[model samples]
Target: MKTTFKKLAMPAVATASALALVACGAPADDTATDETMADETSVAQEPGTIVAVAQGNDDFSTLVTAVTAAELGETLSGEGPFTVFAPTNAAFEKLPEGTLETLTAPEGKEQLTSILTYHVVEGAIDAATLTNAIESNDGSYEIATVNGGSLTATIQDGNVVLTDAAGGTSTVTATDVAASNGMIHVIDTVLMPG
Candidate 1:
């Protein structure tokens, strides 16, 4: 079946216009404003799946290559509604010397796939939802990943941070990059599951 994709941009409020405000109605509170902003930011992109969305973004090139190499492109493209904490190319660069190269090699596909899957949670979790989850869980929440490991979500310095199984922490650099199937939260560091 053919797919349709959407492009989303955060801080979608480029400028304030009286007409826009009058048409949409004003938000009730600070929380309401944030929720409204999040809703407005979810714009549509090209017609495809989450995999295509990641491929289209230059920042995620390394992630795309890794996913393809790991033979997970199709699965990510499937009807997921997944929450993908995609690490940037710079994040991959943060790895130790030879780490990325070794992981991308044919023999390292299994390990690479495991690590990549660790970044994914099997649902559509946007910033507001995640914040709510954290609040409900009393400041931090543990999430089981597709790779069968778990990650901890917490608020630090007023931003959402994810702690992986190996204890490395990655801050959510960008949130709510909406796709056809799910959402992408950009991270500066790759989460290690082992």
Candidate 2:
């Protein structure tokens, strides 16, 4: 395990290694108070995790709220080095009227989690890598999300575009927003996994 992480840069590797223990199911229930799990919570307070980054950035306020509502903070912040196609605040605003409200409601957590996970892919896949994959796959690439759904990536007018499961399209407005445990690519529109 140690040998595998030798490739990551300084801060990210340290964060990933420490959080990974808790992420891999270190049992944090009241009956089994694992030290690692407690440490994970404290570790999340630092600025390396994706959740921390999102919380610190005003542009991702909506995304942060959705993540919290879905109860995916620990997973996204700890069990990763993930590639998250993060929707910006403006992107969340592009949702249908009342859509965000409905999704954030407690009853909508499962569906919201599914939708959010559909935007995440394992590993730190940067834009250049995505572009290469698209080119290698003959101008498009079918990338599977953390959820069972998939996203199709294609280039449009010199920009990377993602086609969601519902056939709605979103352009990648920004690429490679680095987080300690992942990379965040900001998208202008929310991709639904309908």
Residue-level error in angstroms, candidate 1, position 58: 0.6
lDDT (10s digit) by residue, model 1, range 41-153:
44321224668767767788999999988999999999877879999999999999999889999999999999999998887777887878787778888877888888898
What stretches of model 1 exceed 4 Å from their correct place? 1-47
Best by lDDT: 2
What are the per-residue Cα lDDT tens digits for candidate 2 across 1-194? 00111122323433342233233454556676567666766665344677877786788899999999999999998857788898999999998999999999999999999999999888888777788888878887888888978899999999999999899999998776667787778899999898
Give model 1's TM-score versus the native structure: 0.76
Question: In model 2, what is the error at residue 116, expressed in angstroms?
Answer: 0.4
Residue 33 lDDT (model 2): 54
RMSD of 1: 11.7
In model 1, the clashing pairs are: 6-44, 6-45, 7-43, 7-44, 7-45
TM-score of every candidate: 0.76, 0.76
Give the lowest summed-lDDT range of ten residues in model 1.
13-22
Looking at candidate 1, what is the lDDT of residue 133?
A: 76
Q: After superposition, how far is residue 103 of candidate 1 from its true place, in Å?
A: 0.7
